[model samples]
Target: MSRWPNLKQLHYLVALAECENFNRAAKACFVSQSTLSTGIQNLEELLGVQLIERDNKSFIMTPIGLEVVQRARQLLSETKDLLEMTASRGGSLSGPLRLGCIPTIAPFLLSPLVTLCGETYPDLDLLLREDTSDNLLKLLEAGELDLLLLALPYDLGSFHSRVVGQDPFRLVLHEKLIDSYEANPARYAGLPDHSLFLLEREHCLTDHALSACQLADQAKINPFAATSLYTLVQMVSHQQGATFLPEMALRAGILERTELVAVAPQGQMPHRDIGLVWRPSSCRVEAFAGLGRLVTSCLR
Candidate 1:
């Protein structure tokens, strides 16, 4: 039977893999460079394999070392979960909670929530990453994030979610376009394709906006697309284009300086569900629930 590597050694290996520099890895692990090196050497001896190749200029992990590093990350994640569970059992709310937030939601939602969390749970450690919904979900599935704050309507078949609130979409237009539209709303009915600015493809919000606005004719779609809400706002502010924004974002002062006019649709307001999502099998479900409640409270 092969002997197992100690958790300390596995931690060092993971840190080295991440940093790719012994000195930096040692600093990350809060250990002396010599101690870190000796630990890796002991780990290699115990496993009977050379895990890393080191020279003057660079450090390289062998193929086997790469595989080991992958496994080491999983082990560390499991270890963290175990420790969190233990702490929870002891009635303590302390440890690292990795969270992912979609770009559209993060700017408007997280600032106040972060302040609230800091005041409420001083012991809780939060590690935040911002990305698109698709990317965030991929990270959640890979165990890289414990929870995700996503603007919903995209399919989430295997995950559990708690809806915190709804954020309605408001029509955004350049000041000139607003005056034109107000003077004669029918002029916008046959507007040119380039007059409408939208988020780039692959974002769920783009689809939601299109569907909600009944913009099914592909020929009337905008040629210019933006990757972020901020970019879309910028395009609308500078160029003679119009777009849509979430109500919460407008309320959060997204258009404070811009000469952008926000208007609700005549009929049903277009909106998206904002929620907290987590893997159904997560042991940190309670923590996620707590976070959801806090978020709901703050939003209210």
Candidate 2:
């Protein structure tokens, strides 16, 4: 018979590998530094390999140790999925669901989604995290988030996704900026790249809008980037410049009682497909699909 290191020890090693500091890893594992040290010792004794190179100044995982850490992460993620699957059974939308959403969509989507879950899936505890899509996707890959609510045409690695809604883009400007944005094609063409603003970098919305407008060479992006659509709306109010906004935000009273005017793009509308995404290996794929349907149904 051969002895094996426990899952908890693997967890400790993963934490150490990520943090690269014994003290920080111990804190993350919620154990004493000496306890974490002993766990690693046990693991090395069992595996007959020095997983980490120890030093007073720094710690480095060996090449094989790095591979083990990667596998450990995958193992922990699968274990979590199994536990969540077991909990999801025998209940109608019961148990916790950690969902991540991009900042642009959070304000418009989260409130109603929360209410809908409360009304329909009373047993479900929906935990929400608002962040950039890149950040959210990282969390999703790490198994920190079960699903993501965001706009698509994004690279989601191996995750599977379902379209829940579409948000068309429109050019938003102050009523005073242009006389009338009617059927005049010149007005659209004469749009100054310098007068245009965006929602800052790393926001997929900004990228989508830029691509749709063919404004790659337009260098007039605002020096100070707007953090939220509301901020952009305020800037438009002050006659700072015209910007692009999604149809959902505009429909949600974003332009209400404000002087900003939202007009559909001159020709074919530039729209983003909103989606719900999760790992295909997740046991809750069907469950998440149903949840996705539930979410989009409310949008109708």
Best by TM-score: 2
TM-scores of all candidate predictions against the true structure:
0.81, 0.89
lDDT of 1 by residue, 1-300 (tens): 367789999999989987888999999999999999999999989988899998887879999889988888777767766676777763344577888988788888788888887887788888899988888887776577888988877788798988888878887887777666566554456455677788987777887777675555565457889998889999888986788788777888888888888876433767788899987656777777777777876666
Write one digit per residue (lDDT tens) for candidate 2, span 167-220: 888889877666544534655545555677788888889988877655554665
What are the RMSD figures for all models against the true structure? Answer: 3.5, 2.5
Q: Which regions of candidate 1 deviate over 4 angstroms?
A: 90-96, 118-127, 134-144, 153-160, 178-189, 200-204, 219-221, 265-269, 279-281
How many clashes in candidate 2? 0
Return the TM-score for candidate 2, rounded to 2 decimals. Answer: 0.89
Candidate 2 residue pairs in backbone clash: none
- Residue 138 CA error for candidate 2 (Å)? 1.8
- Indicate the worst ten consecutive residues by lDDT in candidate 2: 180-189
